[model samples]
Target: MIPFPESTLLVPRTLFGRGKITALPALGREFGPRGLLVYGASFRRSVAYGRLHDAARGLVEWAEWEHPGGEPTLDQADALRAAAQTARAGWIAAIGGGSVLDLGKTAAGLFHETAPTAAFHAGQTPRHAGIPFLAAPTTAGTGAEATPNAVLTDSNTALKKSIRDDRFMARAVILDGGLLSGSPAHVIAHAGMDAFTQALEAFISVKSNATSDALALTALGLIAAALPPVFAHADAPEADALMAGSHLAGIALAQARLGVIHGLAHPLGAFYHLPHGLVCALCLPAAIALNRTAMGDKYMRLSETVGGDFATVTNTLLATLQIQNPFKGQPLLRKNEILDQTLSSGSTMANPKRITPADVEFLLSRLFV
Candidate 1:
């Protein structure tokens, strides 16, 4: 019999469906009347934005804050916290991609903290929870809504790290498939890969418990089936499946933690300014290969569930999405630099196999075309 693993599973009250975003106003009112609305810069131009505005009218007073777009920074988090304080916001609501959600979560968690956001990034413990937070993720990647960690880039060090706390968990999450209708094909591809990688990594993580393992397997199956179709045609019927899969992956990773793919992706993203999902995609095959011995049984199970071997499925997906190695033409950072960051990352510690600097160096060497 498998031994029971010690773990804690935390998730928001999730409202998932095609038009669930319309429920934001009613949900927002649960926290308070005045809310800080954080969203993507491009969302203001969408019909969904108008719908959200119409739903929120007279129900909740809100001040809109546009996400600067990209990975969130400490400065951005600080500014958002200040804005929320200035507005005297009773709650925070984010409706956009992962970056926007991370910013919103960070802002809400930091609103009452007097120290710099970097302090939290550097292991400062939060003494107080800011306010009720809600998230409506427009993208199917990152699953930021389900996580209690807000990943931000430290502007000073240019390194990506997370301020993790149970207080960062959303009070509620709105998953609307309708919001995904307008996503570009490349966005779908990149984000889908990120979700897929998260699921795979979580499944094989040493820290994975039974609950996370079950969720990760389900998520991986859905993602494997749904990502290609959605990537080829953004508004496909499979879009909702991909969205759900991504959310599940996020929850799985939140509990199970991730592996070498995320360990390497974080620093690579910091150094190269590449999209997070793209970085995961670039590192996945090599990471999988490195962990193959330790992960063989789990990988075989995943292959059966997903209807293809891990490497074959990943390569095919990469080809379908037209994702090539970003490190092909020029090296972004030295091997030692990548190795150092990889070794220091929390994800690396969760890897099923012991990862040495030599292993990371080998993985980096394979990332080049």
Candidate 2:
């Protein structure tokens, strides 16, 4: 068994409350007067953005960059880095969904690096500590705020992968339920599933330890109980729990890593342009079935935590949220490429059951129908 995690990556300071987003400007002051604020259209339409902007009116010189819709890409990170450099920004704060946060985090982490963004994505080590990165998540998923790695797609190569550096960790995180209020029901559902999968995968990971197990289990319970309500009503009081659950799941996964679902999700989502969470949600049942025997007693622990058999509960939850399998009946494009990437993933290596090419083929067979 993997030993307990003695050292872990973490966000140093975190503020949590319903209205904590209003405090962003004050927090930005700690870094300096100039900063970059990265966000998506959904955030821009919300009242929270106004609150953030009004609060920063005289205090922070924020260069705002709005992310055009779609998965985050290397070019987006490069553009953000250029914007930050041009503004001579002392800090970078992202307030949006996972894509926005990943882009912001990547740009901030590479702010001082002279190498192209692709080089870092290709595993080049970053030698500089980036400007401070502060995160306020608008959606209750991804946990990007709590992790030091940024997963971005390279449009040139059509590859999706993470670039990690200890210095890439967020300097501060604001978990405000108010931000979640603006998320669409579908966004809430997809993101919630992503969080649930992360928590579950981390809990059962071969690399899991004492600290990660504790956190991941708690995260699982919280997300399991709160996701449905939050999905049904964005302003539900359960939003707070969902947000916190997602954050804790992110923190846990940072230490324990994940499993084959994530391994498959990255490659499949990249190839099909599917949302990350949707891919995770679709992959859950098959993953649970694949790993059930290998999970040992931990599988029972998960079932108890989520109330009843975990696999049955997951299918019920997916149906409750109207999550359908999109991969069924689609032609399996880039089969070899997808197989190679999934088999090579770091997350795949961390699976409770060692994933083989046959295991991946089985998963693909289930998805492609």
Best candidate (score: lDDT): 2
Q: Write the per-residue lDDT of candidate 2 for residues 126-226, one digit (tens) a residue.
A: 99888999999988799999999999999877799999998989999999987889688989999999999999999999889988999999999999999
Error of 2 at 83 (Å): 0.7
Pairs with backbone N, CA or C atoms under 3 Å apart (clashes), candidate 1: none
Angstrom error of the Cα, residue 361, model 2: value is 1.0
lDDT of 1 by residue, 193-274 (tens): 9999999999999988778889899999999898888877877888889889999999989888999989999988888888
Worst 10 residues of 1 by lDDT: 1-10
Model 1 scores a TM of 0.97
Candidate 2 lDDT score at position 264: 93
Query: What C-alpha lDDT do the candidate models reach, one value each?
Result: 0.87, 0.92
Candidate 2 Cα errors over 4 Å, as ranges: 1-3
